[model samples]
Target: MKRFLSGTVPRFTLTFFCLWLASLKLIAQENARKVIRNIEIERHDVFTDLNRKPRFIYSWANQLHIVTRENVIRQELLFKSGDEYDAEILEESERKLRSLSYFGEVTVVVKTEGEAFVDVLVTTQDQWSTIVAYVFEGGGGRTTFGGGIEEFNFLGLGKRIFSEITHEVSEGTQIQLRYTDPQLFSSRWTARGNFITGPFLKDYSVRIIRPFYALDTKWAYGFTGFARDQTRRFFANSREFDRFREEKEEFQVFGARAFGSRFHKRRVQLGYRFSTKDITAVPDRMVVPLPDDEVSHALILTATFENLSFVEETQIDKFVRVEDLALGNITQVSLGRTGIPFPNGVKRFELRVIRSEAHQIFDRQYLFLTLGVQTLFEKNTIASFRLRYYNKFARRQTLGINIEFDYADSLEDSQLLLGGDSGLRGYPARAFTGDKRLLLNVEDRIFSSVNILTVQLGGVLFFDAGNVWSEETSINLNDLNYSAGFGLRLGYVKSPDSRVGRIDFGWALNGGGFGIVVGVDQIFSVN
Candidate 1:
């Protein structure tokens, strides 16, 4: 018995020792894997090289622009020294950098320093951040003119300050001021404030939020307050028939928690909101009955599902600029119930659903679809659907198609309209008003590989068809309005924002005459 026990004890000890050695080996292997040892930031000015045309202007622009601070760039990175190397995280970091309006380009690359160490290099090129410009838009014999000064990357700290003054034919003169800080106090919090005053309007809003900045973020919270007093006009056949005064105030606070893996995330949010809206008919103007006033103190619940994936593409929206296209699914459902009854002794229950899906159908073709529905239980409902498709059929050409449908049941003070100011582009603004609307647009886009003094050039030939149905009118397929036009696109490559200037001329097929439309950005956008 003593000999057997001695042999068993020795075998057990040997086995334990072997297992310990194996574990040590495994730990050593993990430690030997390549880790980020250093991070290098390379920042370029607005003009990296001044050898191109308009060198003098380019030099002056660069001199005027302040490059972003290194620490600011580092703060946006998802990784740092001593972290294990991950290509996906690096890609995400690049996307985050590019998302900033200050950067015209962003790239992240890793270099192996030794068997167990890596060096990460991050490169960014600044855009011309200070913009002093005039805004002009003329459509359907109506025009709006304005001028603004904006500092997108104020003091190179990634803050935005903007002030603008404008005059509109319908709204009189307006003055607007806005300030935004993406990283308030160098933390994850964001703050934004806007104030606008016009002869007919006074509006202001403030928001502070710590959003889900990353796919793996665990929690988020925010609060917002808004107040507006405005003159509302009701239009018929592009002419105002009635006017009213509206005053609204809103406040909301929310908190959210995220779950699931980085690739697919699910979030739930709880919130409370208080809002009041009042409308009164103008004394002298053609009087229309005021819409029902509303006051609500509500609790809100929301659930969202998102798939985190993106496709990096060029010339899709911005010419020659890198655009990260979200290519996946996102769905949200929200429910709200009011605890305090309205003055009419009625409680409110609301439901809202939104879904968007994007897919790459082919090597250079994509499709995007979105659906939204908002309903006040037993009172009213509004539903909207959109479809956008793009095909890069040639190396320098793309075909884009957009379709939109909006319908409402028991609409109150709002009206859906389609005309020159919308997408029709050939008739007077707000020529048609109704409870239901449908619009279709098709464009053949041609991109030029030409850069003239830093501006990129493109062109588009488009066709538009739309119709609206009032509640009293029956739907008719034969009543569709049609227009065809061509437009020029000027991409301000050096500008902080990626909006293109457009000028289009459209001829109405129904003998509504010709119109000219001038605006910024594409006429139809997926977002």
Candidate 2:
């Protein structure tokens, strides 16, 4: 035993031991398989039978198209008649089907057909994904109104098309169009295009992805081309810089592969970008120099591992709710390098790591945490962490708390500074910026269900406190800003529910003033 611990064992012995362990696991898996004698597909309506309930005739009238084809459902199945039953494969199939925006709920059940055979039943319920929407959104002393039409599952072929026109209060109007084909030309390749035009911004992009998901597939590939006018209003150490614009064109190509399991994946990407900047309107007080026209070429590599589990509960024709949410774990790591003998003469290396996890605790309570670390080779390192807690203290009530902290060592102007736009509800966009920041948010949510009309209404009261500071200044309690707000949540009833919209009104305690935010099911997440 001592010799083995000291690495005195022969290499062949170690290899044999590994092979033996793998064989044992394989044998166990083989023993678990039962013959699958039959496969069945069950597809439900896009909307619940709300007519059964009084005063829900509106739901019946709003019914759209049934966009998912039976063949589309069958193509995603991991098993077929005479195939062996594997629980992991079955769950994976369900997950893949649910990932489609058109699907509200996906369940795969296996039942014994005879002594040694089982039947596979795959059931799927559709979601109302065709949205012709009008938006009137305002927040943080700004207002934006827009209108859009989106078909998420066009003609049941899993295609998407969206077009919108918007007019901002102070900013000018904008028009946008987006289209996507998940299965291009009846193949596995996916294609996407986006276009946006406005007085201050013009952006267009096209992308294609050949994803690698099959057990026998070795690699995936993606390519993208984009041209955009990016505007940035920089604020550092609580001081603002005049708006800066960069007109840039970029092209990128990437390839990736899975290792050991589909949940673990890695990719390498190469890209070239050409940019010309104009900062003529930059304030004279700004200390940073404006960037000149230049070109850049770079390579980036990334790896990610994801494993999550969740359960979806549905009410017939009314709504689907995801309860017992558990994020097993997810981690991503990336490294990038720029200017390898490039024409633009740029040189930089960057690395980042992100990890997130969620689990239940003590029956009715849950905890979720996310951590991020980033570095620009040899110069600066930034780390961010967030911890969240959720408690279901009552049948229809929940309490949520989120705490976040961010720090930067030797910060640079080119780096992204922590700012209010992240989630300081009362503060205007970019109102605060600094090398370090801290935030705390607490929320109490109450849900009320209107089953007859297939509507779910929720109300939330929240408190937010946070501050950003520079390296030269220490964080002060007096410098912190506080915001108290109430928000309304509207969702449609169904198995696997959908958020219809949200409206928030907040009051600032530290002279930031009052703000109201309106959104259509848009939720913010810490990046």
Candidate 3:
């Protein structure tokens, strides 16, 4: 190299040496400047740009390796760029997938695909697992209750295919079978299950999620056909006491039902429900109101509408989506667990009440009114009106104190409620056998995180005051009963990273033994 630079007698070599020395000195001076800057830049949080800041952005890549049930790689998913330091974008995409609530865990890692690009890698959680459960009950209506078992798989054959089967043998025998397809056929058609169970006899039903609907939530609709053959018994003594006596005649009914619901950002709709029944084979000797008519089947219609909004301009993420600006003073969720046929001796006594703008309050008070219609066609249909009020109690959540008076020819029925599992403890389900039932459960819940899991243990004082009577004011004190209990509850949250939280509560009665109930999702199953 010096030879090439030399002009004569190594003149170029001399010149090259001089230039090299000058350049080396300049580099050394630059290094010294850097060292001096580092010494003066002691981190004290005074200037954040250069103190304790993220170094190099640590660019990463996103990768998804999906395989078959047999661990065979099928395909991989990639975003626009391979290795990029867009933490916000990566986190957002990962969050969307995690919201499915189907995985046990998920992590995103960035990898340098090229000089300035990165890809992401998503690692999924565990797969299908086996689960089992057992329950027992002893009550006035019947005894000899036992337990049951259950098993299901969330990821089936590399897709969202699930199935569950449960059986119970107690006062009677009952069995349930269900299969769900997260992505039905081609769209979001969620196929339901078929159930074969009964109190006194057996019944069968098959349901499906119908396509070709309206609205974005047109995710699915349910169409079901059910048939049941059973008999009703008479407990001659007390109206509250149900004696398991066989009926004189055999009764059969074939029915079809359809259900639809709509869900939005803050609104929930029980959409609509329509059911038609065809009844036959009523023995002539039975003591039915329409004895001579042979008691044909009746059509039933059920509908519900609900809308929830936040008083504060904030989003609330109780168990799922959590935002900084959201205020979640109250958290509640309601869904139908199962449906039952209308109670016997009920053609003219239907309870109806409507509430409008009861949550919003002004001048420290809010009120709503509701009315009911009686006897639409026959003595089987009766209606009533209701009114409710709310006031600021302490926190942002309003104190829900409402009044409802249902006027009906009768309130005698054996039909249960949707969320009956989380109500009145210390008593067997369907324990309250009466012509009229009134219940109130007021709760004040406070939440905190314990051991990384959101622990929501609330204080609930409940009072169940009701009377058993053949008619109004004819109620007998001997049959009248009231129960008050306090509840200690633990709530489990639904998360994409961790297992969904569980809620289990124990309630102690003033005059009864404590009751312990631990179950999934549903609040209660009390009748």
In candidate 1, stretches whose alpha carbon ends up further than 4 angstroms from where it belongs are: 1-34, 284-288, 340-346
Each prediction's TM-score versus the true structure: 0.92, 0.81, 0.47
Q: What digit string (tens of lDDT, one per residue) describes model 3 on residues 95-116?
A: 4433343333344555434333
How close to the true structure is residue 164 of candidate 2, measured as C-alpha lDDT? 97
Candidate 1 vs candidate 3: the TM-score winner is: 1
The TM-score leader among the candidates is: 1
Q: lDDT per model, in order?
A: 0.88, 0.70, 0.35
**All candidates in order of TM-score, best leading:** 1, 2, 3
Sort order, lDDT high to low: 1, 2, 3
The lDDT of model 2 is 0.70
